[model samples]
Target: MQRTFKSKIGILTHILLLITIILLFYSMWIKSIVFLVIMLIINVLFVPSFIHTEYIFNNNMLYIKSGYLPVIKIKLDTISEIISHPKKNSLFTTNPTKRYALSSDQIILYCKDNRRIAISPYDKEGFIRETIKCNPDIKISE
Candidate 1:
């Protein structure tokens, strides 16, 4: 079975992003409307990716995507451990395929191949529970 969950996007984050975008666009218009229009279109297109995200945990694969970003497939077999707190974990950004999140609570996944990725799921506990089911060898730290 595949468990699907939404990303940890808070309302306050969205509101702040919207306000910043509006202010930037308004200010840019003073110089040139063309610049503002082009940048506005680009920025507006990315709003969905920041606001909408879904993660799917299947038998051995975890599929995740934020907005229009490419879907990343993570094999449970490659995961060595998971850390609950982000600060304690020195997250590595070397993974070719990784997720960038905007939530306060994040889980750091350490792969057996020495790669690390940070993930933010709305249901952090449930996500860990399901991940353990897939990879029994995976260890979790508080």
Candidate 2:
């Protein structure tokens, strides 16, 4: 089965952006209009860049691919461990706010080569189920 995941844009983020745009327009600032227009263009043009991320599992290997500038592919053999757990409040506060709904369950991939990829999937349970199906040995924690 081919599974696809897409990060959704948050309602609050859009509202903030709209407010900024309105404020900029009301200020009669050319620079602000230019910046807002540029941002709008970027947002419209970048949908395909993030729309469909693919994960394919076959023959004891998991293939992961992300969209956009530099496409990446990682094999299952390189993954040392997969973990699911809640993120610390301090960590969440320190990170930059995202445009999507905040995730409570964070997925951490510890690679055999000493690399780590952290992802906070929107559907935590589904992500865990799918991931465990690919590699049953993966440890998942609430």
Candidate 3:
């Protein structure tokens, strides 16, 4: 069985994004309807791509895949730790800032070489339990 975890943009966040897009389109200083339209289109297109993610554990390895640009996969044995913590900034951005992964659900996976991957699981507790069951040696912090 393939387990999937989808990260959803909160309703409030989506509303805020729409309002921002409208305001940007209406603003005379940066009056570029085309730009605003393009942004809106991109945002709408991007949401669905992130709505479904899959994590497969098989043959002593774990695979994490998303329906977004630049797919990713991680091996289970290489994972050093799994931490449940709030991130400060959006994961899509390169800037380092504090942002919550999910308002109420977040996890940070640290790899063996110090690489970190953050995810906002839909069912945080269940995911944790399942992860632990798969890799008992992996550390988990609540």
Highest lDDT: give the candidate number.
1
Q: What's the TM-score of every candidate structure?
A: 0.80, 0.56, 0.65
Find the 10 residues in a row with the least total lDDT in model 2: 94-103
Alpha carbon lDDT at 43, candidate 3: 58
Candidate 2, superposed: residue stretches over 4 Å from native: 8-67, 89-105
Each model's lDDT comes to: 0.77, 0.53, 0.60
- The C-alpha RMSD of each candidate to the native structure, in angstroms, is 3.0, 5.1, 5.0
Worst lDDT 10-window in candidate 3: 94-103
Residues 14-119 of candidate 3: C-alpha lDDT, one tens digit per residue: 6766666566566535878787776667657654444445555556565665555455666677777887764445344422222223333557777797677766
Q: Which portions of model 1 miss their true places by more than 4 Å?
A: 10-12, 24-31, 88-97
Ranking by TM-score: 1, 3, 2
Considering lDDT, which of the candidate structures 1 and 3 is the better prediction for this target? 1
Query: Candidate 1: deviation at residue 30, Å?
Result: 4.6
lDDT of 2 by residue, 43-135 (tens): 555444344444445565645544443444456656766656646753354333211222333556666776655555556567667667767
Q: Which residue pairs collide in model 2, if any?
A: 10-99
